[model samples]
Target: MSTDGSAESRPAIDSPERIELVHVGRTLQSLQHLRVVAASLIVLYHTELQITRLTDGIHQHSLGFGAAGTDLFFAIGGFVLVYTSHNRKDTLGAFLYRRFARIAPLYWLFTFLMLGILLVAPSYLLTTKGDFWHFLLSLVFIPYPHPVLGIDRPFLFPGWVLNHFAFFYLLFGSLLFLTSGKRVFAVSAVLCALVVLKALFRDQSHLLNFYGATVALDFVLGMIVAWIFLARNETPWIIAAVFLVGVSIFATGVLQNVSEGAERALFWGLADAALLFVCVSIEKQWGWPECRLLSKLGDASYSVFVSHLFALALVASILRGLRLFPTLGVPGARIVFLGAAWALGMVVYAAIERPLMRCIDRQRRPRMARMIVAKGP
Candidate 1:
């Protein structure tokens, strides 16, 4: 099976090779749906946290598994980039350009939208205070102390993930540029060193601390998974699932007590990797059918994740105006609010984000076409 993107680059295939290709393709398709699940976990986590704050921790749950969504995303991000970039020959400049075009436009639009909201209705937004410089830094994916929250964050709280993402891209992209797609171990080594530095320098300032977090190590774990897949080609679904369950139990501290930080990262990273392994393994072994809703949700995950907070805010505002929460009670209100936020996220994805991304893609097509023509056959 070809792990890399280019099928044409593969050597001549026999019957066994053809069968393996079909299996690998199916596995990749199943993994696509996992994005929606990850995004939903984040949305749920934020919803629970915000509601707990609103209700004075009356319903706060200690588990906070939703926060683990970020870990899952880091793991998935590492895997996908390594998987997709496996055999591509695009220049680092071109690769970064494509990534920026895909990520930045929508993020800028949302950042400014949040800024405008803060200007107009500060009381409604959670992180209300802002500085012009901080806002500008946020637009460029820089880690800055969020004016209101006083944490290393941006006006758009969820956008903090982008900082880690941009750093990973710069690191990986530079390695690709320097080595021309070789020296992968150097990349892994650098990531390991960063994690170790994060552990050792826990007293650093907020911004530096955020940058050095062990969570970034999950990306390396993901790359390892991709390397394993490429090397071995397949694993049994049952074995993968069993391994995942064991990891989950251990992560939950059933066998030993565990807390946050590197401990949590080690457990969650392994658990998320096991999850990816099982999802891909199942589809490869059984040829799982397409799931339209999950696939659509996956396609819209970024939009959903970025905008769900506003959706939840709107729901809260509406409920407050109607005074329905007292009747619904805390748990009931939470359930309703989560559903409303999820629905609004889908709306944002369909109505706003999809069109905006299409416009961006269209604008890039001409430049890309010219570049392709310039490099002529």
Candidate 2:
């Protein structure tokens, strides 16, 4: 439910039937909330080591398993595209318009802001002379814009996820053409192979050209979800499906090995997805309370994800001097700090992220001028 007492994950004001009490319906909404909460977990779980010029200071810290948030985000991206467009009669032009409206405005705003920062803070730019094309190509989101050099931290780290999403949009749309055929299994199998092979190669620079190949399997899995449930409305056996996959995910010790590329890719991608499927199926079998606040949290989740990094930086900077839990030791300090990080993230989303999103949405998707003859005065 949204904070305004409306249901979350339903299409919008005009699409009420979208909020059915069906098993898959419930699961989709539940997945929406789950994605929101999980993305927040990412911000809390990551610890960035502040580099100070001691004889030897840790220059970087792991983001922990927060990359799972990316997987969840990617999965949700595919889910929403299908969820929103599944039954609609959309023209190609209208389809592209809606898709562009959903993503482009805020993305462009962020990209331009990053560009400004790069211009003003030249030190942040890549030492390589070719970054101009890389930055431009990255924005266009085509097949491998490597001449531009890969992302630099603080400014561009978040943008890589955008790259994943751009391609996923293309992937999902291309599959949309096969409305009469069921090639979902074939699609997923191919993408899974691509991801595993890329992981085996294990080259980060290759990520500049081919990172999408690594994560394409997850998006393919998302399509599999659409094919099985949305296409068939196959709800009765959904639980059994979820149970089998859940056991496999757990038995493989996937979550514990978040460090391994192939392992984490398969683990979280499968886990988040199986979790989504189970929740949706359960909802179909039952009804839920109208939780508006949670719905709003889900709505603002994108903002929370993009802005959380900055919020974390702010919290880390402020907490640097306090040293309250320092005496308690690193792990203890990390625990307390994680709690504070989430609270701060919520504040940042409310104050900055949501408002900016509103502006972006309004600026894009202009209403066509209705043909109204000038009234005779």
Candidate 3:
């Protein structure tokens, strides 16, 4: 669930302007493709679950492992944050604002949409229910016990990952005051300290538990990957072999039903980091030709992540209403649901997300230009 600006241009890694590159211009096509892959994994996982429910467990699949895609996304988020911000002269406010502008508006829109459905069509929602405090906390990316489930989920359940992302953004943004080199080390130390504290004290508080989760370590893994990416290139074949090994380990863990916590972070998180490292390394080493379709899907991966629940629910409802499941069967229904979810996500991206981003960029660029000119290069 990431977005990059401009897909057509490719920048040389050692270009003289690299240090001054505050905004990400040249898109990393490999990352874009990975975004699509991660989002699709999640969608497929949910699709399998939906099929099972529709079939009353008569037909079931093990794509529940696809939930590990969240780990992949976290790693990607960490990598992108560092890759874009490192060596730049971005102020804390500026860095946070950019992150907020990119993430919040669409998230808020989807949150409200979910809220409205919970209010007017409560039955339409599978697991979420409307609660004022919970909804409010969700909008601000706070972790609170869900009213219905009593778990630390936002009103839009998938937004749980966003809460972690918001935390990461704050931590990363604060570190922007330091030199880029020191920033990574500082943030990594802070995250490590938090994890250590959690292990030592075993705090049961929702906030502490959420922040202290070992999954947070995935971001550190990604930061390391970014540092490596910026520092030196690895052998492409070795990276590819690492990628294959990562996939094998990740798949094996998923098949074995690895429980969440340290195990998940170690298995899925490490695999995702390796996967991301490979993709970016390959792209940097030997550029990939643009595939517009995958690129577009990658661009909309964030939209897909946020809006997919709605799409899946809509598809499920329509299928149930039409009595299509029995005719289509579990496999067929899974395909329809997955396809519909991705299609709706792409539609949301094109119709809403893209325009919203452009509007934000339009308002932001002139002020940014003034600031740049004022700096007097």
RMSD (Å) of each candidate, 1 decimal: 5.6, 6.5, 4.6
Alpha carbon lDDT of each predicted model: 0.68, 0.53, 0.79
Q: Against the true structure, what is each candidate's TM-score?
A: 0.86, 0.71, 0.90
> Which residues of candidate 3, in runs, are more than 4 Å off?
1-25, 57-61, 372-377
The sequence of per-residue lDDT tens digits that candidate 2 reaches over residues 312-357 is 5555555565744346455555565555555654675567555655
- Scored by Cα lDDT, where does model 2 land? 0.53
Candidate 2: count of backbone clashes, pairs at least 3 residues apart or interchain: 15
Against the true structure, whose lDDT is highest? 3
Model 1: CA > 4 A from native: 1-27, 177-183, 205-207, 245-260
Using TM-score as the measure, what is the rank order of every candidate, best first?
3, 1, 2
10 residues in a row with least lDDT, candidate 1? 12-21
Residue 275 in candidate 2, Cα distance off native in Å: 0.5
Q: Which pairs of residues collide in model 3?
A: none
Angstrom error at residue 332, model 3? 1.7
* TM-score for candidate 2: 0.71
Best by TM-score: 3
